[model samples]
Target chain A: MLKDITIGQYFPGNSVIHRMDPRMKIVLSIAYIVMLFMAKGFSGLAVGVVFLAICYGVSHIPVSLILKSLKPVVPIILFTAVLNMFFVEGDPLFQWAFITITKQGLSTAALMSVRIVCLIAGTSLLTYTTSPIVLTDGIERLLSPLKKLHLPVHELAMMMTIALRFIPTLIEETDKIMSAQKARGADLESGGLVQRAKALVPILIPLFISAFRRADDLALAMECRCYRGGEGRTRMKQLKLTSRDIVGAIIVALTIVAIILLNIFFPLAIA
Target chain B: MAAITVEHLSHVYSQGTPFEKTAVDDVSLTIEEGEFVGVIGHTGSGKSTLIQHFNGLLKPTSGRILVEDRDMWADPKKIREFRFKVGLVFQYPEYQLFEETVAKDIAFGPSNMGLSPEEVQMRVQQAAQFVGLRADKLEKSPFELSGGQKRRVAIAGVMAMNPKVLILDEPTAGLDPRGRDKVLGEIKQYHKTQGNTVLLVSHSMEDIARYADRVLVMNKGKVAMFDTTENVFARSEELAAMGLAVPQVSRICRGLAARGLNIDPNCYTIEQAKQQLLALRAGKGADQNA
Candidate 1:
């Protein structure tokens, strides 16, 4: 049952986006998200799509895999699209007995759906190209400013890093536990709701106990190694932005500017 | 009846994806009832995947797993029954113990089988006894028990189901020498008393050699060899080449045999080696009568 989980998740690549400093990639991901939202019209949306596509291509993550990653969200996408199609006010596109779909609503829903898809695909590129450790390190560094605003950025990043590192380890542990229980005839599947949930108690209780034990061991080991909080911790591999990052940033900046220009010149198409 | 029969079993995880790799290639083997079979292989040689097929815990990407001549996936709904028929205690069994008390933990399995509350209690008690767990430890939380005790509780959880074919993957792993011996002894007793088929998967050839009557060797997802323990151990070189060692005693005998002393390299147990050495000594003494 646990084997269905995807691990060994970080795709190996040497593309331009992969070569960018993780810190830059993290920054660019946030910037791309901001652009996705600030995007005013279809033209702006098109720019975001084009830019994300370029990033995805540069990261060397197959477009098919990115689409596959979207599989879990297809239902949500459809729901949001249906809601948008019925709610937004504009010229009517089609009408059924009690339901009217507007032209404006259709366009808005299509644009919003595409935006959501691009946002996900763009972020996935970050996760796919950059290892979890680097991503967390980038997050910690980027959020360092918010540290003054009581964000606990360091702690959160540390948690994420530790959590990511232990994902495979805990997955392995869960696999062992599942096999052990399955061997004992713990019918994890093929039961009524309550029965199945009750069956999970055996698996969960043990996993929770071990998780706590692991946490304690980790804390003790950290103390033994004199690991203080992020106060003065020196990174073994410091982040450095390079020429590729500059080129990528310039290209992204130009795309955004062009999007804004198109929004001004062709305001009605966007409006 | 054959306890478990896997025919042309193959599994490729994440099939059609770039990450897809065959964890278990085409492999076929039959484990007969009341037999003690040892499965030895390197870490990724597919031992775990193979045993998983026995209980229908994992569906083979292709091929069939038969339990008592019935295909495990015949009904698909009967996989749970298959699990009860073929027990699998994975490595580090302690990771599966979650009940408040050892007693409840041991009872978890039989209860899942839709057994009566009373029958579940009986099986739990009997299984704990089978694994040499003390009556007093039954009330203690599984988390509070020592590693070895937790291990027994985990194993007892499965044994409570009273499976026809019991498969243990490294039952004594990470245990101290004494703990290892006790666990192994209890498992052997359980197998003997129940007269159940046993499949032991271990990296340590000594563990397999000591208890297993038959052995199956896996390499690169295929069966390298499968035969009586004696015959399998005879190919010590091939096993060694696969990074699997022979039983320590058999290995020692081989070294002695290389020094011009006549002996059987097929003896896997220490007792057999000791008896052979004594017989040779007696023969040498009788030769002086000439």
Candidate 2:
């Protein structure tokens, strides 16, 4: 059950998106999200949707996987849509007592939901294409400018990379502990809310202890290796921008321009 | 009647996904009551997965597991009863210790069995004694104990339940030689005094040779051989092909047999090899005197 979490999961592939520079992918993802919100009318949203569809095709990631990433945010999406539908004021599309669903409200709700879905899909595509190590490297390189202000950019990136590396290890340990407790007749399933919370005591205490132990071991190992605050460390694989990254950046720029032009030509219906 | 019976049992992990794998496949075996059966296999050969089924921890995808002539999954609600009947001490069980005191950790299983508090305390003391834990250490927190002592406390936790069959998966793994021997000796003593079935899963052929009366060899999720310890070691070459080795003494006996000695090649223990060599020496001495 703990294995179902796919956050920050990278799928290994040889597609163009996978080959693009990590920094370029990260920048392009931020740009995509910006354009999604900047989009004013149906035409702009359509352009964003088409752009995502093309990215999905080029990345070769299955549609089902992209949909699965949205599972955890379903409630948030529904809440936002419902709020927009009831609150936005305009000509009434349907009237029922004080709760009137206006034409503009309905349109705004649809647009908001579309924008949120596109936002999630675009960001997940970035994680799906770039490995965590490369992503951290990209972030460290991008944030290196802040080093002049003594912000410890490299140290932050190193911590993130280590955290990502240990996620699966900790998950495996939890699974083993759960099994051990179950063998001792600890009923984790089929209980009231209070009973279920009580059952977690057996699992949580051991997990926390092991996690602390692992952290101590890791710190000792790092010290033994003379690791001192990520200074003077050189990467074996330096980041290089290739033709694919240049082409991806150009496409993102063009999409942003197109969204702006579409918004100017076809004004939003809600406003 | 057999204490446990596995009929054409097969298990596939993550079925219908791309990562699906047949961890245990079409395997079948029967273990009788009061018999000590040692399961030996290379890593990922289904040794752990198979033992988990004995206590209904894992359900077979294609076959059945019977504990004392009753299907383990016949009544899903009663699966907890099987856990009480078959105690499983998983690898590195020390990490499972969570109680504040060593005594409470040991009593976890017995209390879960709904026994009276006095009976739970009695079983806790007995289990701790079986693992050679000193009585004075019972009041201390488990985390305060040493590594080996923590492991003993974990084992006692399972033993307190007084299962009819005890299954240990590499109970001696990651322990020093002395610690390993202590744990194995306690397990042997448990089996001897309780006179109940014990299934020991290990990768050390020597440990099995010394303690197990019967050996079950698993290769690529299939039972390669299941027979007496002597017979299993006699086929050392076959075991070697499966990336397993026999006891050092058994290897020496086979080496001597290859050199045309009249000694038995199936000697699986040091005592057996010593007796054979002594008899051979006596025969030589008599021939010289004659």
Candidate 3:
């Protein structure tokens, strides 16, 4: 059951997007998120959606995965959409007891839903195409300038790398513990809220104990290997921007510029 | 009656995804009640997956698992009850211990069975005793105990449930030779006194040779062989072809036989080897008199 979580999930591939520099991918993903918010109407949001679709195509990620990434955000999308539909005041389309639907509300809801979907899809693309280690390395390199400010960017990235590395291990451990407890007749399902929370005691305590033990072992092993933080560390796979990354950067930059221009030149029809 | 019956069992992990792979495929086997069966397989050969089905920990994708003639997934709601009937001690089970005191950790299983408090307490004491955990150690926190002791506590926790069928996956893995023998010996004694079906999953051929009445060999998610221990070890060539070996005694006996010694190549245990060599010496003395 714990295997269903899709955190830091990287789909192995040799596509153009997969080959693009991780730093550029992270930067462009942030740019894409910004473009989604910058988009003022359907016209601007449409550009963002089109750019994301093009990315999905280039990355060779299946459409099913794109839909899967959007599953978790469906509640948020519905929430904002429903709130906007009922709360916004514009041309009234329907009325029922104190609830009213407005044409402007409908338009806003549509725009918000599209923006949120595009927002998640765009960022998840980054994770899907880039491995966690490479992604952390990119972030560490990108944030290296902050070392001048006495920031512990290397340590932060190292922690992220370790956390990502152990996610599958911890997940497997949790699965084992759950099965062990289940075999002991622990009823994890079909209980009152209090009973359910109480049942988690067995699973959680063991999970925490095992996780801490693993962390302790990792620290010892790292020390044994002479790992003294990331100071003066040389990477074997250096993040160098290739022509593909340059082209990706240009496309993302052009998309953001286009969204801004679309917002300025073509406002919503209602306005 | 069979303690557990698997019919055409097939399990696919992460089904329908690109990562989907069949871990167990179209396998069927029946384990008679009160039988000590040893399961051997290479890593990722479906040994774990197949046993998980015995206790309803995993539902087969396209098959049925019957525990004492009852379909495990018949109700799905009562599957937890079946767990009490068939206990599974996972690999590195010591990591599953959570209660503050060793006694409480042992009681976790019996208490979960919804037995009376007195019954739970009694079972805890009996289980701890069975696993050779001393009375004084029961009150101490399980975490304070050594690794082997903690593992004993974990096994006792399952034993406290008094499951009719006990399945342990690599119970003695990562233990020293003495610790390994101690744990296996305790389990063998438990099986003897309880007269319950026990499925022992181990990588050690010698352990199986010593304790298991029947050995089930799995290869590439299918049952390779299921027969008496003597018969399984007798076919060392077939076993070696599947990346497995018979016990060291059997190999040594085979070496002796190849060198023209009157040794039984089928002997799989040190006791059997000694008896065979002694009898051979007596025969040699008789031949000299003739």
Error of 2 at A131 (Å): 1.0
Reference-based lDDT, each prediction: 0.85, 0.93, 0.92
Least well predicted 10-residue stretch by lDDT in candidate 2 chain A: A1-10
Q: Please provide, for model 1 over A222-259, each residue's C-alpha lDDT reduced to its tens digit, 9 standing for 90 to 100.
A: 99999888887898997888898898788878887888
DockQ of each: 0.73, 0.84, 0.84
Give the per-residue lDDT digits (tens) of candidate 3, residues A1-271. 7889878869889999999899999999988888888988888889988888988998899989888988989999999999999999988999999999999899988888888888888889999999999999999999999999999999999999999999999998888888889988889987899999999999999999989989999999999999998788887887788998898889888988998899889986444
TM-score versus the correct structure, for each prediction:
0.90, 0.97, 0.94
Candidate 2 is scored at a TM of 0.97
Q: Which ranking of candidates, highest TM-score first?
A: 2, 3, 1
Interface RMSD of each: 1.2, 0.5, 0.6
Q: How well is each residue in B211-282 modelled by candidate 2, as lDDT tens digits?
A: 999999999989999999988988888999999999999889989999999999889899999999999999
lDDT of 1: 0.85
Model 1: per-residue Cα lDDT at residue A217: 99
The most accurate candidate by TM-score is 2
Q: Candidate 2: which stretches are off by over 4 Å?
A: none
Candidate 3 residue A141 Cα shift, in angstroms, is: 2.0
True contacts kept of each: 0.94, 0.71, 0.94
